[model samples]
Target: MTQQTLIRAAVVALLVPTFALTACSKSNQDQAQNAQAQLQQANKNLEQAQQNLAEAKQQAAEAKAAQEKQAAQKKVTEAEKDKAEAKQKQSEAKQASEQKTRQARSEARNQAKSESKPVCSDCGTISSITPIQRNAQHGSGVGAVAGGVAGGAIGSQIGHGAGKTIAEIAGALGGAYAGNVAEKHIRKVTVYRINVAMDAGGTRTVTLNSADGISTGTRVRVEGNNLAPLH
Candidate 1:
């Protein structure tokens, strides 16, 4: 309780003695009655203050409980979001795998049909084989053009007058040849270029990425652009 409440209690305690002394004198009966009334009012104010404190504690408890509940709900919501993302990723991976399988089978069938035979899922057998370098960028003549330009620039820097013109022409020719060679060296990959004789008596040319024990007369299967040795 407050200091005012404690002081009121002290004053009431003293009033009993005070009243007795004044009653003995019997000269101030009305003043003693006034003290008693004030003591009662102070006691009432103390009780009201106590009641207000109890209500405030209850409200604080309720607020804390509500905050905890909201945090729990938020955790649950975040967990659900994470679960949904994982499920979506798994579904995408499954679809991609299935699509890749279908494409591989379709490509194999097309390769089989290249032999003028009925389209099938496999690509026949190896009849004749050659080890060849395949350059991804060489067939378009872009290399030659770039090479010629670079060669002419170099040639123009070298000699003077008529000799410079001859040098440019010679450099261009040389550069074109070098560029073609450089492209083959830079972009070429080694593979066994094989002619496959289909079981259906039609021949198809196939490029296998590696020899991998495959040779002339070796039977093989084409799954998409990949080759597998026949068992």
Candidate 2:
């Protein structure tokens, strides 16, 4: 063949080998770059997931703490109510006991007053009243002597000698006895006898010249030998 054609063929053959080698090296570099980009994206997504998990844990812990605080507050309120109720019951019991004690004291005092005894020593109740009469004076012998002398003189004037003497003696004796009886009747005293039962224990009798205001069932007081109204 010709010399120029032969040289051209040689150049073509060398250029084609150089171009294929360059293209293959470029494709390998591109594949490595794409793999590195995928790895970086996966690392970013993992970090975001970890942050979200930590936030959720923190919110759960806060909610638990709030519940615990509310429970503690409710227990404290119940305790305060129980204390107030106990104090009120104790106060009512003490008041009732004091009232009962006061009532017992009042009853005791009333019983003592009802059982007391009497105080007067000279007081008495009049049980009986009786009217009586007594002679104020005894007969004197002077009246008897005067009446005998007058009766003897009168008898002597009526009769003679021995008969006059016997009549005079009989008249004198009768006149003396009559004069004594008249003297006793003229001097008489009226009185009242009162019988009393004493409070201290015995009975006594009192004589009064007059029964003006005293009667049976009357209260009286003894003074020396007399009695007075006790009202």
Candidate 3:
């Protein structure tokens, strides 16, 4: 072969190999840029998903808190209702107790009245009369009359003369003696008597101030008197 042809062939061989290497390097660089872009997109998508998850968690927490608050409110309302019902029941019970107490008192009073005994209306019981001393001047009525006359004479002395005063004194003395005699003749006061049974079954006689006609075996109950079973 010629030198010119040989030199040209060698140059061609080197040029061809250099061009293929350049092409292969460019292809590899393009592939690397594509991979980087895909990685960036994946990171962006992951960030968006994380943000959505956080928002969902926050909403769930808020809902749970609201539910708990509602439950607490319901519990408080129920407690108040229960308290009101209890108070109503207490008031009703108190009213019932008061009514029962009143009924019991009324029944007790009726029982006491039923158990009471009747007594004589006239002379309440049989008793003795203590006689006043004889020759004793019964001066109660006469003293009242004489005192009035003496007071009148004293008052008359303030307005009238001696003649009026003398007449007043004579009238006062005469009226006092007549009243004394009448009181002595007519005052035959009789007293009533009573017999009370003691707890030991003993009988006691008591003198009363008024006349009483209580026959034997006559049932009697004194006023303001009470009897109870011995303890």
lDDT of each: 0.80, 0.84, 0.65
User: Ten-residue segment with the worst summed lDDT in candidate 2?
Assistant: 136-145
Model 1 clash tally, residue pairs: 0
lDDT of 2 by residue, 1-231 (tens): 899998999989998889898888888888888888888888888888889888888888888888888888899998988888988898899999999999999999888867877556888999998989887566777657766776787677768889899879877877776677777777778888999999888998999988788889899998877999986
lDDT of 3 at 131: 29
Give the alpha carbon lDDT tens digit for every residue of 1-231 in model 3. Answer: 999999999999999989999999999999999999999999999999999999999999999999999999999999999999999999999999999999999999999878876433322322223423343345568554855575556545553578677666665666566656666665555444456443234454655554344444443444433211122
Clashing residue pairs, candidate 3? Answer: 123-212, 123-213, 192-210
Per-residue CA lDDT of model 1 for 186-230, tens digit only, reads: 776777777877765677777777777887777778766666787
* Candidate 3 runs further than 4 Å off: 1-5, 113-231
10 residues in a row with least lDDT, candidate 1: 115-124
Tell me how candidate 3 scores on lDDT.
0.65
Pairs in steric clash, model 1: none
TM-score of 1: 0.35
Which one wins by TM-score: 1 or 3?
Answer: 3
Model 1 misses residue 176 by how many Å?
A: 91
Candidate 2: list runs displaced more than 4 Å. 1-28, 110-231
